[model samples]
Target: MMNDEVIKLIENRRSIRSFEERPLDPEVLDKLKRLTLRCPTGGRFSVIEIVDQSKKDKLCALCENQVMISRAPGVWLFLSDMERFYSWMKEKKCAENFGESLNKPGIGTFHLGMQDAIIAAQNAVIAAEAMGMHSCFVGDIIENYEEIQAMFNLPKYAVPACLLIFGYAKSIPTSPLTSRPEPEYVFMKDGYKHQSVDECEKMYEKNTVSFRERGVLPFDNTGSYIEWYYRKKYTSDWMAEMSRSVGVFLDRWLSDEA
Candidate 1:
């Protein structure tokens, strides 16, 4: 049934930040969990679900004090769980549980957990879209990683990867399908070839034209447009700090398995 649903869902999905105080259906929630597990994972990953309002309340603070996220009907905090797998390894007496040994192509279970969490999170967005829900990703959750992780009291090697917040819509905004580079420009045929400066400039001009047609004011230099968005988005210093913190946490997560 769901295999047939992707076509419509992909066309309609949009990130939504605002929400009303409504809850999602229990059955639908169950379906979401079931299908999420069906997503292909990289390796032994752990599942950490937080559905209670008590937990959701802290998320608002965790999201750099975002005022609106906790109000979302469905939210998820995906973690790359090394500790959980370690416990499972001890219980199951399987090397793969702790993580693949030093002979593997990756950081064994740690990378797999991140992969699985990403797939599951993406699947959640798709499923929610099919159900006529709106969603926004919470990249800012890591801004307060220490307190946020402490709120959940996460164990060692268990860290927040990303968050997804979804809700039923009051009124869908007539938002444009965000401009993106042409598929050929970004998608290489093979290997990691990059677009040249001229190519980048052309793409920038294309976006500028598109923005002006949409009546987005001023029609000034693209750098100003980018900087405007940059200021609004990366206003907090925590973003850069969190990135460094994540690198450390990831290194730690991979250390044992590596």
Candidate 2:
């Protein structure tokens, strides 16, 4: 059985859009810092920044122009980093080029940094909820990733994972908690066997009715999910341009060193 504190937190963790005027208690803020520090790092350390209303509004505008996010009062940005390791290694750091340094962390450092950053972000959110606060995870912060790098003045090695918003709760839906596919279906006992695209669509189709009831626009199938996602996220020229440019920049950056 889940622990009492964990169960209560899980039940209370609601994704809130609106908020009360109160800022979080300083004691609660301290707790989040401690909890996040214990989050699994995939063996690599990361830096996290908690954002305020002014910065959050600016970031929301810059990232996606989404007014909803611009209105949130508390937010945390999880960033993946490799430069910090290089700093610790001091001048002794070898593999001067990015691509060449892939082996430095034993071939999995990059993934570890990402995984660690995300887990830490989740910890902050869950802990915030346990203290009677509400939160939401905003993935839009990276939609314009290059802009994100520039906006934060990020140097060579940090990538933002997500934005975790916090505040006192206002209203939340009374809808049934969303269901997952059978545990057996989602949990693999051994090696992975990939499913076909058509078969994948079948599984998605079964979830569309529930999604609609939850105010999710109709996604009758995976293709429909694709259509809606593309329309909302990919159609923006600025978003696409930034995405392509960032990929090119990172590739060139990686190409420059070992």
Candidate 3:
């Protein structure tokens, strides 16, 4: 039912961690930047493309020393940025109209900005894949929240939403594409359906098998994949830090006293 260029592109896309050392063609890079900016947005956001070795090194450290950050030849940080808008409002002398309330962006603004940034980042990733470049989304940039903000000298209203690393693929993957939940398990005909434990297990059966084959699951496989994944990801120290950092960013963005 779906046989088209877009469908083929979507089907072939994969998370590529390794990349070639060569730089992207200048024209391609420029087009990518333009395409990212053309994405739908609720409000203004920002992009910081890191090509400099020094900055990439710093970003690598901030993203928990992910070597891929430094090796990818390009690292793009998409940010939920209200700083420019706020500054513009102040420069236009409209800050007094909203008074102190203008200083606080509130949760709504934050949510909008986050959506804008993430959507734009996804656009860039897809565009890169079409242009024959592979990309990986590193969400760990939010883990070192304060340090990342300091590294970029970002204001309270400007928060990092995603980090994208892209370059020419080192090699095409020989293995089959990763498995996913069946269509029935993922899509709903009308309303949401909360699956029972057995249904959930059945849904994850393929994923569990694939992970085990790929050596992604624990060696011992003591408990169910759900429990293993929950402890490894949801309750891991990295996730804890990410949650804490997001909380701090949210507090700063919504704090009228700040």
- lDDT tens digits by residue: candidate 1, 1-258: 565567766866777778766777898888777766777776445555667877777778766777567677777888877666566655676766567542322366666677777787887787777667777887876666667767888776677777888778766779676666777777787698887767766766656566556555243543434444455446647767677667766665556542
User: TM-score of the candidate numbered 3?
Assistant: 0.91
> Global CA lDDT of candidate 2, please?
0.65
Model 1 residue 174 distance off true place after TM-score fit, in angstroms: 1.3
| Model 3 misplaced regions, further than 4 Å | 1-3, 95-103, 214-219
Question: Lowest lDDT 10-mer window, candidate 3?
Answer: 97-106
RMSD of each: 4.4, 4.7, 2.4
C-alpha lDDT of all candidate models, in order:
0.69, 0.65, 0.85
Candidates ranked, most accurate by lDDT first: 3, 1, 2
Number of the top TM-score candidate = 3
Off by over 4 Å in 1: 1-5, 92-108, 204-236, 254-258
- TM-score for every candidate vs. truth? 0.79, 0.76, 0.91
**Deviation in Å, model 1, residue 96 alpha carbon:** 13
RMSD of 3: 2.4
At residue 231, give the lDDT of candidate 2.
65
